[model samples]
Target: MEFIIDTVNLEDIKEAVEYMPIVGVTSNPSIVKKTSPKDFFKHMKEVREIIGKERSLHIQVISKECDEIVKEAHRILEEIDDQVYIKVPVSYEGVKAIKKLKAEGVHVTATAVYDLMQAYMALAAGADYIAPYVNRIGNLGNDPMELINELSNRIVQDGYDCKILAASFKGVQQVRDAFNYGSQAITAPVEVLKQIFANPSIEKAVNDFNSDWYDVYGEGKGICDL
Candidate 1:
């Protein structure tokens, strides 16, 4: 499973990659607005430099019209490098853009997917990834896990190449459920990911082990020191 960070904060991205097996970085206009970088392309290039070429970088298009979305995707590729996965919303126009981009062999991620039909359309359009808003869907009284499960089954049955990149998570459980439901990837904020190790029991266990080791090894002595 691929763990992607869904933010544009460089410091967080650097820290996350340093400690975890981060596979990619994904950004939407709302995420970009949080960082408010002075130069968008330059900032994205810096992000690419940090993650390196092996990892994928997904950048979203802002336009709503089909032709404008396609043009925006081209502009992003030209500005940020063609390897960047252009994220287009799963709307009528956006699906059209996804088809056009995929026809040209460009990497496309269909975003803002809320229903099974949206995901089906994206998969049919040959989108590389389909992002379902897990938390948002749950807030709307819908079962996000059910949605992911159905999509997962459909992908396997139809032999589609698209992978589910679950997004919009508010808690660690949501992340775990996404994976449990057969999502191939998940993109979440660094804070949410870090919480996986935030439990007090984990730290208490580590401290107890260290205390016992120090008591037996004579104060500050450790295995390497011995």
Candidate 2:
């Protein structure tokens, strides 16, 4: 599975890129709200530069009408590279806009999905990606993993090219679960990525190896061997 840095912090994104092997960056209204930058587009441009043109930059549109969504999508398209995937909600109007944009060859990501049916609908509407809020589903007393698995099976059965992007990850377990269910990608926060390296056994293993190596040779001698 692929990981995406779901944040607006440039420093965290850079660190994540260096260590996590992320495929993209995902941003939404809440993420932007936290940053509260004066120029959202300018920040997006900086993010694009950091991630580079080869990686996907998933961005959301704040429009309700298909025309407005299209307009926003075009604006973002011009501002960023071709890897920009414009995200829209899973509402009635959003579905319409997704269809129109998809027909026009614009890459569209249908976000805010919570159920198997919504995932199916997004694929049928020609969305390039479907973002299901897995944690949100669990909060609402549903099993997000089962929903993701069902959608994965459906996508396989229909031979659709759409990939499941598991969003709204609450912790590392949700990320693991999403991947275990065959999600192509996951959007998680920086803290969660850091937690990937926080296992006690991993820490102990690294420490023990370093101690043995230090006992064998001094720091200078180890450096010389390298």
Candidate 3:
């Protein structure tokens, strides 16, 4: 499974990429507004430099209309690099925009997907990745894992090239469920992902091993000293 960070914070991106196995970075208008960089393009360029060209960068488009969305996507590609995946909400216009962008061989990620139908529409429209709102879906009294499982089965059964890039996670368990249910990728906040190592038992195990080693080798001694 591919892990992607869902914040535009440069420091978070740098740290996560350096320590964790992050495959990409994703940002929405709200996320960008958190930092509110004066020069948006320049800020994104800095992000690109930090992650490098190997990791995917997903940038959401602000337009809600079909024509404007298409135009905005082109602008994002021009401002960023061509490899950047334009994040378009899976609305009526967004599906249209996805198709138009795909026709021209542009990388697109259909975001804000809450329903199976919306995801199917984006898949048919040729989105490279379709993002489902996990927490949002659960808040509505629906099961998000069920959606991921069914969608994953359909993708294989029908042979669609698209992938499930699940998003909107509130905790680490939700992320694990996404992958366990067949999501090919998930984008979550750095804090949430960092919790994977927050279990006290994990740290205790390491401490125990170190104590045993120190008892035999003496304090501050190493294998090189031996």
Candidate 4:
């Protein structure tokens, strides 16, 4: 299961990249607004430089019109590299833009998906990725994992090429749940990824090993050299 950190802060992005072997980063308007100084393109360029040119950088288009979305997608792709994944909401216009972009061989992520029907719609509309908001659905008192599992099964059943990406993860539990349900990717916050390594036993084991090694070697450069 692939994981992408959903953040715009450079520090958080760098922290997650250092700790986790993630493939990419996912950014939205809200995330950009949170950390950036209102210059979205500049922030995105900073991210592109940090992650390098060969990384998958997912950016969302806020416009509702198909033409506008397509134009925005093109702008974002040009801002970074050709590896950008344009994320548009799951709507009629969004589907139209997705089809057009996909026909042109551009990777599209149909985001803001809330239900199983929308997931199928995204696949039918030729979207490369369908993102289901797991914590958001769970917040609405719906079983988010159920949707993740059902979509996973349906995608495999139909052998669709659409990737099921689980988004809006609350914590490590949600991340683990998405992978457990066979989600193709899990997009989560950087803090959540850092929390995954917070196990006390793992820390204790590493500290104990370091202490023993130091005691045995007496801070020597190499035991063999001694």
* Number of clashing pairs per prediction, in order: 0, 0, 0, 0
Model 3 Cα lDDT, one tens digit per residue, 64-96: 999999899888899989999999999988898
Better of 1 and 4 by lDDT: 1
lDDT of candidate 1 over 61-150, digit per residue (tens): 999999999999999999989899999999999999999999999999999999999999999999999999999999999999999999
Instruction: Give the lDDT of residue 71 in candidate 2.
Output: 93
lDDT tens digits, residue span 73-179, model 4: 89988876678899999998888899899988998999999988988888888888889999889999999889889988988898888788899987899889888
| Local distance difference test scores for all models | 0.96, 0.88, 0.94, 0.86
Query: Model 3's lDDT to the true fold?
Result: 0.94
lDDT of 2 at 173: 86
Q: Candidate 3: misplaced stretches above 4 Å?
A: none
Sort by TM-score, top down from the best: 1, 3, 2, 4
**Tens-digit lDDT string for candidate 2 (1-226):** 7788889888988888988789899999999898887998899899888888878899999989988998999999987766689999988899999999899898888999987887788899999989999989999999999988999898899999988999997688889989999799889898987888888999899878888888878643566686
Total clashes in model 3, counting residue pairs 3 or more apart in sequence or in different chains: 0
Give the winner by lDDT: 2 or 3.
3
Error of 4 at 149 (Å): 1.3
Q: Could you estimate the TM-score for every candidate?
A: 0.99, 0.95, 0.98, 0.90
Q: Which stretches of candidate 2 lie over 4 Å from their true place?
A: 218-220, 223-226
Better of 3 and 4 by lDDT: 3
